[model samples]
Target chain A: MTTTTAHMSTNAATLSTPSDREIRVERIFNAPRERVWKAMNDPALIAQWWGRGNKLVVEKHEPVRGGHWRYVEHANGEQHGFEGRYAEVTPPERVVRTFEWDGMPGHVILETATLEDLGDGRTKLVSVSLFMTTADRDGMLHSGMEGGMNESYRALDKVLASMK
Target chain B: MVHYSTSLDSSFAALADPVRRDVLVRLARRDASISDLAGAFEMTLTGMKKHVQVLEDAGLVTTEKVGRVRWCRLGPRRLEKENEWIAKYQSMLEARYDRLGEFLERTRGEHP
Candidate 1:
């Protein structure tokens, strides 16, 4: 009785329609919600998988509202640090936090990760990252690279036109 | 990084205003004099100049003095790299989730 709409995703995670100031990513993990939560909250497990392919070490992880979290990754002989503040932390359900990449300095994004039980042993995770502005979000999309901003600028024009 | 981000902040802040965005849109289509921008926006010369000043500060637009008029045009590389940084991290996040799934499976096998 899986009501999950068929997403045209070839990978485990599906990054859906991204808006001007937000990105929506969803993934279904073949584990219970509690297990999934523990895997994310536990610094030991987080260090193992948080880096994608880089070496990540968790310097601090405080899993409570108003708690602070920091982690550093070493890659190519350079250390990159990331830190955030937890806005809300509800076990096995939802967590809201602000994420900032120290590499970029002032760019910060507020993210919310929500978990839903789909019966049996499957859990669905949806995470949304909200940027401060459309340009910020667009900048992330263009991060570390170069591309024309005409499309995004047009989109920004539409957004601004609608707001007026 | 501080200087880079501050410029981006200025760019975003400049684009946040509807009038400023419209002025950008107009300039993107063609180079315009400050007077032309002011005329299109139905704003005063000083008002439009302020918007242009913000855009110039962000490096989103550039202006040059042509005789008694100032001609403004779009910046050379507009937000091209901004999307790359975000896109890179997005793939990183996706990879992390994939690894997490694998880790969870291995843990299950180990305990079960």
Candidate 2:
């Protein structure tokens, strides 16, 4: 009932849980809606940003409805694979897709992203991910605490420590 | 199945009240007696006790009577875990978005 908003930093994305089974992330990008949409759907452009500067290989990408997409990110000598199928796609407006990580194959998240034009060459992206159940949502969130891609930072820390 | 949902429902119900949520936040900083909490929040002892009771029922707070004063503190079930997870998730997204923002800046004229 109480929405928990986590603001990472100034001028960054904000994440919240609006319902028991949903996680919402809202962010503003300094670009037109069309350009943002193109970057999101284009495989090369997605690789440029989706991996947080890590090398990302877009093995397959099809933004059309019912199309399948897969991406592999290489970080800290580990590969993280993510794949999904597009349920709906409306260019420069909205997209609905199913996202499943290879580490946790059976647990899939239905994600909906909407782009709103801010009219000043900026766009607001609202992404809401719906889990099958509250437990699934909690599990996915907690799983990030351990073996998720975020662990690469810890691995990097170890590597840096050895160098010193 | 029923037990899990019931406990989760109660936790949500307990957190629904702003006062109760504030109590948890204050307790997270340090434990305090019931009277201390009531005085800090500017509420009557009876009213603060009721809020603490709700939190206790939800397993979010625990109270113990030390002599005459009843001390309250966070229970075994801490909401900090959930908050930490959300914060980490937000940071990960923010990092990727930062890169996305940079890409947009570099390719602005090309895209237009």
Candidate 3:
């Protein structure tokens, strides 16, 4: 991580409708829908990835409609906690949740994630984070989203394989 | 010194702001002069300097003088430190899964 040779791809203009605090990261996994869904639903499987390499403690995880989940990521002695309630849970298809974290008052996000089985045992995960306004979305994007998430997705690819 | 808060707190705090993160993002590609950075923002140059100072404090960027212009480049170390800290948390979960997998395998073998 200390290597510091970093470059960013500013594809902000490519987004269909750029929201102020929205963060979207799409990943195509070389696995079946069921397996992909398992990775997303199971906290054990999730702990392997999803956090971009942060050590996560699953305080609660009820991955069903109207269920709530809370977790903390510990790093460098500081703790980052996030909690949310699930709005929808259709296995191997889609899940919607309300996401809120520390420092940010109010959730400001009604997130919906769609899992599409693109045939051939491949699944595409699209996460849409809807924030209060474009400024909040832009704020998140600008605030280390590119670097943090890029590193996380890379780690997720490896975790999926190790688990399978 | 933050004896054990993890090295990423400062970096994360610095990046909590969009303006500071923008400064770091710009430095991700190449170093830019103060004016060049100020040109990219809607705020005044003084406002931009305040933003850059946050990045500087977190060790994500470094500014230097080359004649009348000040040059800034991506510090890179702060990110590496932050990544290392975040990766530790992920590693913890992965290890737990390993134990669970082993337990499941043992149970399957014993039953079947």
Candidate 4:
């Protein structure tokens, strides 16, 4: 039985688990596919947004097949490093890569990001991450929560208060 | 982060086994006696007990003795914690995507 649940809802993004070992994040951006693709691939532009307003240092970014990329985001006096290797890089369409966090070594996630043109200058970016095992996927999910728990606690408090 | 890492490591270790994961999934549907679980998984009672023990240690499952049977169910913390983790993951990505949208707006006219 598939117990897929919508954990949270936002105006522009949706996250879902399509399978036991997969995570799919889909977002609609008010921009053309090419623009969205460039922002995702260009190191300078990636640094501006990938960190979620945190100080992002793009150590190495080569958005090409077989290229390596590393980015470090500084938040709350902590440095979080992420590195990956591009497996496929078809511009304005799809990019596949392996994402690994520095904190947890050897638990790499294979991510495939596809940009779809929705017309009228809109683009849909779908990113699916496939993990080696269900446990690895669960571990990654928990780590994400633990890492951002402090920063998001106030927002969660507001949510809880509104619910009550 | 260290504490989180340690706890997550144990959780991952506990869930690494397929049988244990299946046990959690089965328990999520309804509480079952240890014998019931062993029968469903077609494993020996002692083997199933070992898997349940690992899940219990990770706080993913809870077991109790009622008369002659040891009943197992999803732990008190399991579903809530899983939902919270998923929500946190979604919100984190949403925040980043919002920033990405802003960045796209700023560089709308730039050539790729």
Measured by lDDT, the strongest candidate is: 2
DockQ values per model = 0.16, 0.19, 0.04, 0.20
For candidate 3, what is the TM-score?
A: 0.48
Candidate 2 residue B55 Cα shift, in angstroms, is 18
Candidate 1 per-residue C-alpha lDDT over A121-164 given as tens digits, one digit per residue, 9 for 90 to 100: 88899999886645665577778433446767788999999999
Candidate 4 residue A41 C-alpha distance from true site, Å: 0.7
Alpha-carbon error at B46 in model 4, in Å? 46
Name every residue pair that clashes in candidate 2. none
Model 1 misplaced stretches (Cα beyond 4 Å): A1-11, A133-164, B1-79, B109-112
Per-candidate TM-scores read 0.57, 0.56, 0.48, 0.55
Alpha-carbon shift of residue A72 in model 1 (angstroms): 0.6
Instruction: Place model 4 in a CAPRI quality band.
Output: incorrect
| C-alpha root-mean-square deviation, each candidate | 18.9, 15.1, 19.7, 19.0
What is candidate 2's lDDT per residue for B47-74, written digit by digit as tens?
9999999888878888999999999998
Clashes of each: 15, 0, 18, 0
Model 2, position A161, has a per-residue lDDT of 100
True contacts kept of each: 0.41, 0.49, 0.00, 0.53
* Candidate 4 Cα errors over 4 Å, as ranges: A1-11, A135-164, B1-91, B106-112
Per-residue lDDT of B61 in model 3: 75
Error of 2 at A68 (Å): 0.4
Residue A144, candidate 2: Cα error in Å is 32
